[model samples]
Target: MRRKLTLKDIARELGVSISTVSKSLKNSEEIGRDTKEKVQAFAKLYNYKPNNIAVSLKNKHTKNIGVIIPDIVHYFFTTVFRGIEKYANSLGYNVIICVSDESFDKEVINTELLANGSIDGFIMALSGETQLKNDYRHLTEVTEQGIPLVLFDRVTDEIKCDKVLLNDTEIAFEAVSKMIKAGRKKIALLTTENFFNVSINRELGYRKALEEHGLAVNENLILRLPFNEQIDGIYPFVSNNEIDAVLAVNEIFAIHAMGILQSKGMKVPEDISFIGFTNGLLSKYASPPLTSVAQHGDRMGELAAKMLIERIEMNFVEGKEEDFRTEIIKGTLIERESTVN
Candidate 1:
């Protein structure tokens, strides 16, 4: 009874990255001739066969792109989808979308389902639970199996794939600095746990802005809310804190805080100012029209799609190797009625 060899096993045996083993087994020119021969010999000696999904995908052209997002209800996700569909369709391809609902299990399921000969490639954002667990084996498996994958927004470095990102830290810094310049002495951050990369970056920006302005970084002023918790979950923190301004990581928190403040007779931009991360519908239509850092989800999606399509078309030819790229899109600070004029 012998076990089948996997990419990780081959990589560990050869003292190389899983990506290197994958490319080598595919006979990519990116791998040195010596390494490629060694890897191929090892694979043959161990009876290693590529995953059926990857083999099937490579043998046929589905002309369908699969996308998995954390939440479809989110304005940012919807906008990104629009951009992906627009670009993919223009190139004579269709898209299949799945919602992970912030669950790691769902993310794995969606990816596996899509990979089973249904789509040509994948574009996704990491789920909250996936980030919390810090487990990217499912994503890694897809890549190791020679599937083209592109990650956008909530991405992790553990998976070597093309990524589209927002300059979240820079965007948050600018938004927080705006509040500080408006004389906000006690600014606070409303965010999720540091497990989420986006939240962590925004928190960093928040801290950087305060420290650069000679303001003390108060640990107590930072509130980490549960992901997608009810609006009421944020009430007690805002009620008890003396925060003159708040930098929320998303529109949900920012809009919820605004309602809570108004209910407590605190006027926006008068007693407490706020700036949120996403410049979506809520930010634009909220009472007082929330000031926001407009992360261009559409542009990120377009770029991500473009990258994935390019990789898919490359198709791992004998003389070609994929060079993964990470594209960072800058955000714009949209001034509105939520902040002081």
Candidate 2:
């Protein structure tokens, strides 16, 4: 079977510019008849197919960017959107936002809706369902067309493009180490399923910290919860375990577990120390407040927007190959009333 050929491949093989190949394929008047024939014949021989989305985007420049987030109500996602909008607007670009609501189908539909030559590029976080399903055909389609995409926070390695991420493992290790230093031995990890890349890294950090501190990682203490749902099993999990510290992947889980434990006569930082990710309003306003990791969503959004815009502009440059990048933002742990100092 013949390997699929792209515009770049055809241009390189025919010793012509990609723009010339693109125009020739469409029989544009800009190309000489002889050159057009040569290009067309080569393409026909290779069974070359043009990506309609790529053709439309390369033919016209759109000063619009599309951003898709998993949930609109989440504080972290909202902050990230703010940063993206702020940076994109400063560059004289309009931003269109879409909420995936943690659904894989919604994410795919949103990508299709925006990839119709409406936007120059896309910035998105993988939806929970998208990660769970581990299918990234929609993302791969856009990238295959040479469209710029930047995934932040909830991201996957299946699709290769630019990405902005938190140093989840390092920060999680720091958080767990702090709890261990505070004389908490039986540390519990409350996280989403391992399919989510961020959760997987954080869990690695959690286990690393426990092992490094001479504490055995107890499987019973690890509670895997469903993403974006009201947690139900926290009470039973806590009641059944002798946990001295809890590390939740997000503020929602930390706050919910703390509230439940407090109602059960547990004192924050004394009976059990609690720490979660994303230092949002819930972390600040929760009873006794919660010590949390600041994921710096705003900075992540700004970086993602910057990368996507750079890629979009670079597409116009002749004969340049895409150089993908992954930018990591360091997270900070905020001390609060929930954890012992």
Query: What is the lDDT for 13 in model 1?
Result: 94
* Candidate 1, poorest ten consecutive residues by summed lDDT: 315-324
**For candidate 2, lDDT tens digit of each residue in 1-341?**
86668999999999999999989999999999999999999999989997655655767967889999988998999999999999999997889899998999999999999998888899999998999999999999998887889999988888889999999999999999999999999889999878889999999999999999988888999999866564887878888888889999999889988888888898998989999999999999998989999988889889999998988888888436557899999999999999988
Stretches of candidate 1 off by over 4 Å are 1-59, 228-230, 316-319
Scanning candidate 2 in windows of ten residues, the lowest lDDT window is 50-59
Number of clashing residue pairs in every model?
0, 0
Candidates' C-alpha lDDT: 0.90, 0.90
TM-score quality measure for candidate 2: 0.82
Query: Model 1, 18-68: lDDT tens per residue?
Result: 999999988898999999999999999988987655655667868889999
